[model samples]
Target: FHAIMNLFLLPLWFLSGAMFPISGAAPVLQALVWVNPVSYAVSGLRHGLHGFAETPAVLAGPAVCLVVTGGFALLTLAVAVWQVRRPFFQT
Candidate 1:
């Protein structure tokens, strides 16, 4: 689980534009960033802290981030419950 989380989070950090602006990334990478939910959260943080000198077209604003965050939370909760209820090994 730790290894899987590391594998997932490493790309998430990079592709979410935490290390650099998404605009400066390669076209393929930019496409990936747009699809990543973390990118919207980063955009919201940047906007709240620095203001959007040039907002990315993909980000609708903080409201979108809130909605996405809530959705992810609910999804995670549901998955956790499902996992807990399921048998570790089927007969």
Candidate 2:
């Protein structure tokens, strides 16, 4: 389970711009960072901590990041609720 999750989570973390700013990354990587919810979360946190004016370069403005993060949260919440409502076993 640990290895399986790492396979998914590790890439997500790396592609999330956690190690470096997305601005200096390649176009493909920048696209990946833009789609990564974790990236938005991290950007939102950074903006909050450093204030919008002083944060490191990010894919989107603080408002955009906040909206995307909130949307991702709502989407995941909806998926979780949907899954919970489904039968656990099809037997």
Full-model lDDT for every candidate: 0.78, 0.84
lDDT per residue (tens digit) for residues 40-81 in model 2: 888877888777476666657889988999998899899989
Q: The CA-based lDDT of model 2 is what?
A: 0.84
Question: How many clashes in each candidate?
Answer: 0, 0
lDDT of 1 by residue, 1-91 (tens): 9998799778987888878877788999989988787777777777787665775543557788778767866887999899999999999
Q: Estimate each model's TM-score.
A: 0.79, 0.81
For candidate 2, the TM-score is 0.81
